[model samples]
Every structure is written in structure tokens, then in C-alpha cells.
Target: MISTDNFTIDSTKSKAAAAERFINLRQQKKVKEFLVKQRGYKRPDFNRMILDLSRLKWTHEKIAFVLPVAGASTVSELARGGIPNFEHGEALIELWKSETRVDRVPREGEWQTYKYEIGQLELL
Candidate 1:
């Protein structure tokens, strides 16, 4: 590609990068839309997982660990009536289910207990 000036322009790299970004954004949009629409639709598996975690006394921080890609912020948001990305919600539900099935106290709870070692980790 060339501009009004005599200088030549390489648009191939820029175009590819832009296209990739567009696709990612498109996917995110779709996920968000699906989640919003499913608000009324009941997901028995996901609902059961939430109830089980609550009964087990799992904190939001602990629950957030299930959402590796989504993180704690999204978990908090959902608690406060905020929408989250679909992929994050799905990952969180699935992991929570599996972890509960293999529940091990004093043994598996090692990860559940010492999961968040809060100290010099955060920057102020």
C-alpha cells in the first residue's frame, strides 16, 4: 500500500494483527450475549455446583481459583449482580464440580487452604 506521499507502506502485518483482534473481540461479544440470554435458563449442573460450594464454606477467593482465566474480580462481580464472560463462568463451574468430587480434607485442602498466600504478592 502507498500513501499520497512517495513513501511505501507495509500493511500486511498491520492488517493481520487487526483481523486477529477483531476475531477475538467478536468471540467475546458472542460469549457475553449467550450468558446474558441464559440468565433465565437454568443450568442444573452449574446451580448444583454453586450450592455445594456454599455448603462447603468456600470463600469467594477460594471459588475464584476455579476461574483461572477469569480471576477473582469476575467472581466478585457476579456476586454483586455483574455480568461475566461466558468462558470464565463455564470454566469456574466445571472446575468446581470436579474439585468437589475429589474432595480431600487436610490432603486436597492443601491447595484449597494455602491457595492464596497473601503477603508480598500484591504491589501497592
Candidate 2:
């Protein structure tokens, strides 16, 4: 007679087994089919748009009026299309470095701003 009590799996082995099970789940027919379908999609040229958008710097109050004027209808567009070019941004950085502006450093929150419309802003 086989004694189940004598045979026990260690915790590490059980964890590894669980991980293998999870990986196998990802390879199931439905998931495989879905991933194959998704791979057929054509992603847009976000890089070019991001390069074009990255040229502007705007204050919080200006974003509401600036975005539409800058030709970007959405916030994500600005995030991807970094302010046209970094030249003016570099200038501002330099000016800020010289202590000419009290608030000059570009912070994390600054990048998400959807301020400036196309006509209202110029790309450097």
C-alpha cells in the first residue's frame, strides 16, 4: 500500500509548480489565439508625433487655452510628441541653470501638461 503521508512535496517545489502552472495558463488556446490576433495590429508612428510635440513649455493656467491652439486635441499627444524640438527647452534649462528663473527645472508633472494649441505655440 502506498502511504500518502510519507510522500510530501517541499514548499519551494510547490511554488515552482505553481509558477509553471501560471506559465502554462498563458499558453492556453484562447490566450494564444488572442495574442496572435493582437500581433496583427499596426501601431501608429508615435515617435514622430512625440518629437514634434515636445517643443513647448507651458504654465498650469495656460494649458487649458494652449492645447487646442497647439493643435493637440488630447493630453497623450503632448506626452508622446515632445515639445517640437528640445532647443528652446535647452535654452530654458540653461537660463534656469544660470538662476535667471526661480522655477526652471522640468519636473515629472510638467511633461503631462496639455497646454498650447498649434497656432498659439511655435515649435523650435
Candidate 3:
């Protein structure tokens, strides 16, 4: 009887392990599909990126502070349609991607309201 009980317990354990493995494999497949979809997305050009950032209420000085570029003047020049060096261009692209996640950007007048709400939350 004891041997039978042990066998049943071992069988249950094996089933649970198999189920966990299946779940993990499914999750990995889903992640791969998500990555494939993301890869199909084309990044915006530097000019459009600068324009979008401006629409989001970002100033050239603020962008310069975050970027590895020379200064605010460099950012302003880029905004005016000057091409950036490879390094600066990559940095701007990265910044644009990080800041422009889906549904996180605010409409024209909503940015200040969102900022105020964030500030209020931080006060706590």
C-alpha cells in the first residue's frame, strides 16, 4: 500500500513538472512573437523625432541636457534640419524610443495636467 501511494505521488509530481514546462515554453513562444512584431517597426527620422519631442513640450536645452551632443545649440541646429553625427543620431533615437512608449504621450494641453498629477503623487 505504501509503495502504491509513493507511486501515485511521483506520478502527480511528474505531471506537475510537465505542466510547468509546457507553460514556460508557451511563454517563450509568446515573447518571440512579440519581438518579431517589434522588429517590423521602423524608427522615425531624426527630423521627425525632434518635431515629435517638441510637440511633447520638450525644449532644445532639455534635450541637450539628456543627449551626449555638444550643447543646446547643436540640438537647435538638428531641429532646424541639420544632420547629426552617427553617435548623436543614435542617442536621439534611443531617447525618442524611451520617451514615446505607446499611450504615454499626452495631447497638447494634457502634459501640464499630467505633470501636476505626477508631482502631487510624488509629494506623498
Q: Pick the candidate with the highest TM-score.
A: 3
- Clashes in each model (backbone N, CA, C under 3 Å)? 0, 27, 0
Report, for every candidate in turn, its global Cα lDDT versus the true structure: 0.56, 0.44, 0.69
Looking at model 3, residue 109 earns an lDDT score of 33
Residue 85 lDDT (model 1): 68
Kindly indicate the candidate among 1 and 2 with the higher TM-score.
Answer: 1
Off by over 4 Å in 1: 1-40, 43-48, 69-71, 100-124
Question: Which pairs clash in model 3?
Answer: none
Winning candidate number (lDDT): 3
* lDDT of candidate 3 over 1-124, digit per residue (tens): 1257346356677789999999999999999999999876643346656766776778889999999988989998887768788889878877876766533433333433543123123210
Lowest summed lDDT across 10 adjacent residues in model 3 is found at: 115-124
Model 3 segments beyond 4 Å from truth? 1-44, 102-124
What count of clashes does model 2 give?
Answer: 27
TM-score of 2: 0.22
Per-model TM-score, in order, reads: 0.36, 0.22, 0.45
Residue 75 shift from truth in candidate 2, angstroms: 53
